[model samples]
Target: TMTIANSIPSEENNEYCNQFHSKYEPKEILGRGLSSVVRRCVEKSSKTEFAVKVIDLNNLDTNSEDARQDALKELRILRLVQGHANIILLHDHFETEAYIFFVFEICPHGELFEHLNKVVRMSEKRTRGVMRQLLDALEFLHSRQIVHRDIKAENILLDAEMSVKLTDFGFATEVETDDCLTDLCGTPSYLSPEILVVNMYESRSIRVYGRPVDMWASGVLMYTLLVGSPPFWHRRQMTMLRMIMEGRFSLDTPEWEEVSEAAKSLIASLLRVDPGQRLTSVQALAHPFFAKQELPCVTFDRRTRFRSAILAVRCLCRLHRAYAMPARLELRRLRADPYTIRNMRRLIDNTAFLVYSHWVKKAEDQNRAALFENSPKMDLAAQDSG
Candidate 1:
């Protein structure tokens, strides 16, 4: 019953706006940004709740092509990702002269960092789980010849079970046939070196950047998830920008002492200075960090199928009870699909191998102890004893 296709010829209809208000009663204000206000609303018929993002066109200069394209681009990408499980779903949308309305699947748990802020830092297992969904969404976009220029944790939302849903494609763009794209439209700290700031007067210089910008941001995401802060963070803006441009970041922090080399390798590969050297989403998924010897492939047994279905339903009910999130039936469809089942099985299996376990921590402690035991003073004492 709800649909959002593409832009139509601007039509004047007060009835449409009035009908929208009648159909969905706004409950609570969820969030507000400069461009839009997100409100929790309930559809009168089904009584299902959804988040409504209201963009007031009056705030933007209608004559500015840049502003118009910026708003439309999000709708376009949302339309493109109709069936994508890891991407946010667009339930319904409408546009009037004064405002454009977007109804989205409500994600009650909120932003990834909001969760991270509570935990301080994530265990490797939790981080990997989150990163898997992020990579899945990114891979989906990349495959469709689209680049989500911004891949920050704030743009990632969560359901109750903590599965990620990637959102906010306002800066996303379709790659040309040449596979080249250029835009200085990402959070400055997360920006890749290639999104060069060209002077307005400079016509000769052509700055071409592409998907690797996302890879760089993923590396930053990886670091933040594991270490609780960005890799290139600095007190000064220029300093941070310089670090990103120069690819000057290190895994030599105290957190890295516990982190596995496999994780470090993935981060280094993603944060490569040259875009060509950066890991693609596919390659990153194939890296050792994500590898597992055995995957718990779903069985044909009826009990196993029933159990999975029940677990999923229970999870949904739990979330629904907490914050009234709408049923994400698309996810139920994915759970039924064998391909998603297999992929999830392997992703779950791989988390068992992360070095943050007790044995690795004990090994590190022993190694440090052994180094001190074999110190120069100990060596001298040993020689004297001999």
Candidate 2:
């Protein structure tokens, strides 16, 4: 493979001739895909950790001209989208005798799909935080005329802060004016109606699809995050595809009860059968679903309030029982002194305030804790109002 590396006629391959092992020390394998293996690597000088994808070019299947083109395309897309905050950052690339090494910022928290599986579902606030970042990333890509054909939970990475880092450019492509992407690609669960239409009737269907397909997939991701499953999942693949093509999915199920109407409305717009009618990334970000609502001035819960009131009453009752007899004799004498009665009233008010304040503080703490439970550090209060 090394001797034949120069035989590849691509100019892009010539740009990267550094030995992969000379600069970075490769560590344990992080993951493996169809044609590549991702391993953790650290730069010798900077000692900065990164994820390196090593693609072997020795195998006959991976050494073809088409394979080389695909690799170059991915590298181009990564370089184009690198600086965006939400998109994965590509540091550098290297080419050796038998492998191509692409170094990217390491995301230690793993895939969002794995996180969703562990939590089952996410709170609306957390879901909003994730969606906002995802949308912003898409907006950047679309603005540049690049479409990420595959947008699924598995392709999204989570960092230590739980922020989104969209990855996987294996199917991404730049769209030119008047370009019609008819290739049947992407995971089945996230396929847009237009894409499926093309697949169902390959030659018969002449419909064009591009960026809106990504919006549709984002809608699927939002639904999955909020409801714990894809909107159009089914036992039969054909049935699921039909449902997707028809835009058939219900948000009226019990799982959706807790989700806000604004969120449901946004999802509806994204899932529109007609690509032109679907909400673009900019429109989706401007939707009311992501608008920041003010948290209440006071975190009040009925049970907490009631418990405080009950306890205050119980204390009063116990005090009365212990002081009733003494109070009768003392009242006659004390009633003559207006100052004593005023002092007693002030004491009672102070006691009540303390009891109420204690419960309210406890409830507020509990709310904060629940908002962050098993989640990343994010400003959820701005996104979620409990």
Candidate 3:
């Protein structure tokens, strides 16, 4: 039984900090920034792992009041977007006199930025999968009128399976339908032209710039994922801002030669100078680029069911052997019989062939069906047959 303390009153805040430590054993620091450090923690009772972000209130670099407010704002936004699949889960939070702790679901693989650093670049298939999850999370946020003002690679975390878990809502804010956000926030390379225009020239010409800013950041992220570098980056900060403002990024680079035109087109649409002309989250999700890159949907039939049953039985058999053979000597003495091994190998080969065959057949069928449905001749043939 975990006691979830939503918030501790100012008077009892210090006392609750002890309670948090009692419930969870804080471990090694996972990451660190100027204002905060995230550490791995394990709940005492259940031993479930979590990530705890501890924000220092006494840091002279940042105003204590503003830091506290930012922490509270992140808590509110995390709660608002709770249960979203692609967004990071906030299990609990605690605030003390000197620190505020945010307990989140542990993403063992760390930030997308770190992953991209290692891989340098991702294949179109991998990029599409990452983009899809990111866009879905963004769409979920936008639906609730919440803008994730910061959507850089550093803020995006990855779980064990490499699924996107969007985090760091410190800059997130809820906007009404007609509201215009003038805040010049987010990473420099990922910031939209509208934000830069306002930031540099203090221009009031861009009357509306809220959710579209997120779209622009997402576009930058996609470009980064595909090309291994930000599209608008420059050696100098001012030069980078100028490039972003002028929309001077080029797809003519050698890195982009292998990228599909559909992807380039979507990036262009998202990075449009006019925020109004930029694709919304929902529209971006519907882009042809993703459609082309997505894997074919798998439909389970009798053969798949049979193959699953065989695999399940094999797993059970392995479990049975494990339970029955505690001693290494006994396990070595009663090894898998030749008959059993042969049958297992045959079953695995058959299963693989059947699964591959089924997938190829399904994809071909889907493509043929799509073509036929779109053809006027097929429609006339149906009419004649009727």
Candidate 4:
């Protein structure tokens, strides 16, 4: 590795790059995705580590504007919602004519999906605890008029302490609470029924979709966590859409046998087909599902060879949904990114590290104070109390 420069003296560094090379040296790559890659980097001055999300604008899938906008949207959204504990911090942003760089806090534990792969099933206590943090972050985003169109296990990052930090706001958008957005965004399986055109098969009309989409995805994530698979997973897009529009997911899986009724109820309300009927972030927090639960460890009753085989297959199918959207099409009204053989290998091989540290009891006082120090806690607290 080249030595960290004493100073990066260049015209663009003076304008776009934020003393980048002079202060930090790029290290090993941490993760990869469709159009971007994250690298582990360290600050020479402080020896502090961070993840630099690098996007090469030229290679950023030119077929559609959504691919490029996802990058810009992430930057804008990060600027808007940076202080929440459960949201990843964007320490700095740098740009050149051909590239955009986002300096984020190092999430050594990669993603929640990787963690689940190892632990198999999470106990209700752990799942509820995570839901609290996830909802806390979601509540803040919704209050700021921002909707994180993408909410999945891979997009969520984990710090060393196991604190859930929602990441990847590339598809996020800000809109008025009462208005509707007409974009078909987010991963296929995690998408809410309200946004799909086919959902209005009987009475076709453009509908304004909004925050409830994230709530629906949260339901998918919650169900995936408890049962080891997504509520919506199928081979083809139309097949998946049909199941999603019909709300064909159920809590009848064998793994859900030991799961609680209250948890199932929350998932039902979140995965509602009608946006008007879905739970808001605040309402989800107050639901009985997030209430304190006893017996802190999760138990997966089936470890038989057959069950393992089924889980492995389901896991691959779940991963496919992330990259299943086709790349380009001349659909009458809508445009989509071309889907060649782009993410075929990722499904069979990709496993993000989802490890996180349980909040240390020794620093309980400090951690608790820091949790809401600069966050939008009062709004939710007041609403819950009322």
Candidate 5:
């Protein structure tokens, strides 16, 4: 477990010494990945909390200029993308001699990975909601010509209402066309077959694959959500690569049987071996699975689940900052206390239900009124079209 040390007065030798301190006070370390460490910080002026991803360049494999170029590319891509709900908002960034700092929206509930582990397989409805949010984010990225090479549960963050925030653009790259890319990157299990086979051994002379890589990852995520594990998992790396090449998957599991056929069909479409045949974000959105669902109702009560979760996290964060205690200790205490988690979950559920119900009723009323008002116009259009 990562520990958060008390904030000590910065010495002149500290790498962050040169960077201008934002109004937000530094709080605690969130988690560390291969090249970066995330810390929970708050703006002193606004008292708004944020997550800061501090990337240590020294840790990167700098044997060649390729590593530097990739790092610079990620920074550039993130800077290019602005406000989008499904995407994690990047507030500000700077760099020092040792590290690059990226301040982002603080997600309280943590990674989707943890959430998936805690719950049994989510319902098809819940899965659809998450998929919708993810597609929205991905669609936005694809529109900007950015391909998030890595898309997995761990990279998705959840707010209090369990709203999805697509994050970690470390492996993302901009593409000019639907070309096959030979970059051997991303988590092993989520790698598309073309990437795994073509990119791994043949370092050069491989085609440039585009956005489909992301779509493939989305399929893997869908599979994990519905079945509770990756479709392809092997004890050996060689076997896993072979399985991926063969496009072999088994849907005979008991858990797989329980998932809706519509959801399974969508996953199958997304997991197509040929990138061209895979479902585009827009096509996936138009599928009956998503089309049948009502527009997401945004209500104060509906927002409650997330609000309560955020509040609890904020409270814990405040306590951690004031007391200078380890974050793991705080999390353990909160997690151990069933009352805290349950109350928070209930608050979100109840609030969401109330908000959704109110909106639905309002929509029906408005819909009826609109039908009467536009009756003549509707009849004319129907007749003209006919």
Candidate 6:
């Protein structure tokens, strides 16, 4: 009889951690996926935190032999993905009799979906910044002949400084053998038109296409970011599929008033109905939105500065919670960090920073002028009230 531990959830009853069992102590549940549950754990020896994804073989649709084969396939594919910043970093994976464990780098900030929902929307400049990094990641993956079949907001995560990191490779497939896959699997909203058509007809003769599918998904994501909801939304799945297949949508929203024409044009290019017409990662990189933007200088001191600034903010928030002190104290400490101040100075050198600075200054001046203009009216009203 299997006695369940209070620490593990009932759904994960069939799974148990065995690899490096002596090192890590499970802390809390991070999330639950279709076939696995991820937990945050701390390595006792190094005091380093990691995310452990436990997949139960008994819960899967496969027998022991098939489970082993699928595990090996996943491992091989994960190993092949090298030096991609956008993809999640897989440290190690091991299997026990009843479960498979995968150790990954802990992303403290959580998924992009959560962030976007919390904010409701992001600024065009910030959105472009994020998209650029995502494109770089995709470029690296496509260059390695890998197709991240699943690319959506949920799979994209944020690091401490709000840097984007792509996660979840369970649905990813590599394009190594010139094999066209027919398995239509991905979030429906982001699915390309071709996928909708195949699914509509229930045709097994259809084959999985190449990297363009990812590009189409990227376009959908771009649209989602610009407009609060997906390009096509319907109460019924079939109606949604019809909209996607027809490629009929308009961006003529009041929100478009604030977004740049260039940005809108890029979105149009990426969201083209024809996969072949969609912008490739390299071509997208060359767009004005990402063209010649200076990336942060890669240096040990710079890295330390950025990390310290982020950590200080996190620690300050935690301290405020624990001690019931004013959060401003944390802000003061953060501002006093010489490293952070210097990094801010360097950040001003970036083109984006310069553009933002100009706008900020202009807005500040206008605000001051508006206050002055309103003073006489306010004074008149006060006099009458008095």
Give the alpha-carbon lDDT of every model.
0.71, 0.78, 0.76, 0.73, 0.72, 0.69
Model 4 error, position 288 (Å): 1.2
Backbone collision count in every prediction? 0, 0, 0, 12, 17, 1
Q: How accurate is candidate 5 locally (lDDT)?
A: 0.72
Q: Which lDDT tens digits does candidate 4 get at residues 68-115?
A: 566777788899998999999998777666567899999888888778
Alpha-carbon runs more than 4 Å astray in model 6: 1-18, 61-68, 176-179, 202-207, 292-386
TM-score winner between candidates 3 and 6: 3
Q: Is candidate 2 or candidate 4 better by TM-score?
A: 2
Q: What tens-digit string does per-residue lDDT give for candidate 6 at 1-386?
A: 12113534555434443344565777778887656778887777888898888776767776866876676677776788755776678876766666677888888999887665544457787888889988888888888888888898888988777888887776677786424655688877778876765655765444546787788888878877764556766646677678887787777744466677888888888888777788899999898876565888775788789999999999999988887853333444333442234333234223333343333221212211121111112243345568
- lDDT for 181 (candidate 1): 70
**Over the stretch 1-386, how does candidate 2's per-residue lDDT look in tens digits?**
12222433354345433465567777888887766778888888899999988776755464466677788889999998888889999998876555677899999999997786556568899999999999999999999999999998889999879999999998999998423788899988789999988767857544678899999999999988886667876646788789999999999854566689999999999999888889999999999999877976888799999999999999999998997765443644344432235344344334533443333221212211122113223344445555
Off by over 4 Å in 4: 2-18, 63-70, 198-206, 293-386
Supply the global lDDT for candidate 2.
0.78
* Greater-TM-score candidate between 5 and 6: 5
Q: How many angstroms is residue 250 displaced in model 4 relative to the true structure, after the best TM-score fit? A: 1.7
Q: How does each model score on TM-score?
A: 0.70, 0.72, 0.71, 0.70, 0.70, 0.69
Better of 3 and 5 by lDDT: 3
Candidate that beats the other on lDDT, 1 or 6, i.e. the better one? 1
Query: Which ten-residue region of model 3 has the weakest summed lDDT?
Result: 367-376
Candidate 6 local distance difference test against the native? 0.69
